[model samples]
Target: EAAVTQSPRNKVAVTGGKVTLSCNQTNNHNNMYWYRQDTGHGLRLIHYSYGAGSTEKGDIPDGYKASRPSQENFSLILELATPSQTSVYFCASGDTGGANSDYTFGSGTRLLVI
Candidate 1:
């Protein structure tokens, strides 16, 4: 089964501060993604990578960046944190079959900006 895990279950950040959220996967899948979940909105993709050393912007990549240094690790970087960016972030991994394939998501990282 594909498994994804994220660090710092909860975080509080000051405005304009930088924050890095880490994710690790055990399934060795080629696709990894970062998404933020907010009330009244569906999970919006922030970034994704097909494999290590490759990161592509997603639907909501404005305040975020991503890095994938290896098959098992991916990180989301918030260069300038803001209250608007405060939300639950989830990391996911899945097969390359697109929508037909189910993605396994992490527990989520709740970020609170002050």
Candidate 2:
């Protein structure tokens, strides 16, 4: 079975501090994405990777960094956390090659920046 797992399910960060949210997949998917869920706006893409050693800027990449060290692992990094960055972040792995994309998502990491 394919699965995506995220660590530190909940986190509290002080303003200006750094935070890293991690995700791992067992499905060996080549593409991964990081997104944040906010009130009224729905999910916004922060970053994504086509595969290992490649990272791409998504719709909302200003405050986020993404790393794909290997096919199974991807991480989202916040260099300077801020209150506005507080939201639930999700990591997903899948390919959008065609009409049906089989994406496996992590439960999510809830972040609160004060």
Candidate 3:
């Protein structure tokens, strides 16, 4: 079966350091998304891409960057990690056909910046 996988399920980074979270999908979905879940706030989109070589800024892309070098891979980068960035990040792959289209999500990556 197809799946979405994320690396380094958990990570601890120092403030001002750089962190890169990666995602890989076997579902062949054309759309990939990156989101972060915080305590008070719900899941917020950080960045996304429609396909290879196309990355778009999402609702909350201030402190994050995204790269889609290939159709099956996407990466989220934190150039300057900070405490406020500590959260559970999720990666998802989906189709753009319709609203009912299925979306496969990775387990999630828990990041802590101290």
Instruction: Note the residue pairs that clash in candidate 2.
Output: none
Each model's backbone clash number: 0, 0, 0
4-93 per-residue lDDT for model 2 (tens digits):
999889999999999999999998788999999998999899999989999999999998898999999999999999999999999999
Measured with C-alpha atoms, the lDDT of residue 114 in candidate 3 is 99
**In model 2, what is the error at residue 58, expressed in angstroms?**
0.4
Candidate 3 residue runs with Cα over 4 Å from true position: none
Decoy 2 TM-score against native: 0.96
What TM-scores do the predictions have?
Answer: 0.94, 0.96, 0.96
Q: Give per-residue lDDT, candidate 1, residue 100.
A: 44
Q: What lDDT tens digits, residue by residue, belong to model 1 across residues 3-109?
A: 78899899999999999999999997889999999999989999999999999999989989899999999999999999999999999988798584588899999
lDDT of 2: 0.93
Model 2's number of clashes is 0
Candidate 2 at 12: error in angstroms?
0.3
Pick out the ten consecutive residues of candidate 3 with the lowest summed lDDT: 96-105
- Model 1 TM: 0.94
> Over the stretch 21-112, how does candidate 3's per-residue lDDT look in tens digits?
99999999999999999888888999999999999999999989999999999999999999999999999999996884667899999999
Clashes of 1: 0
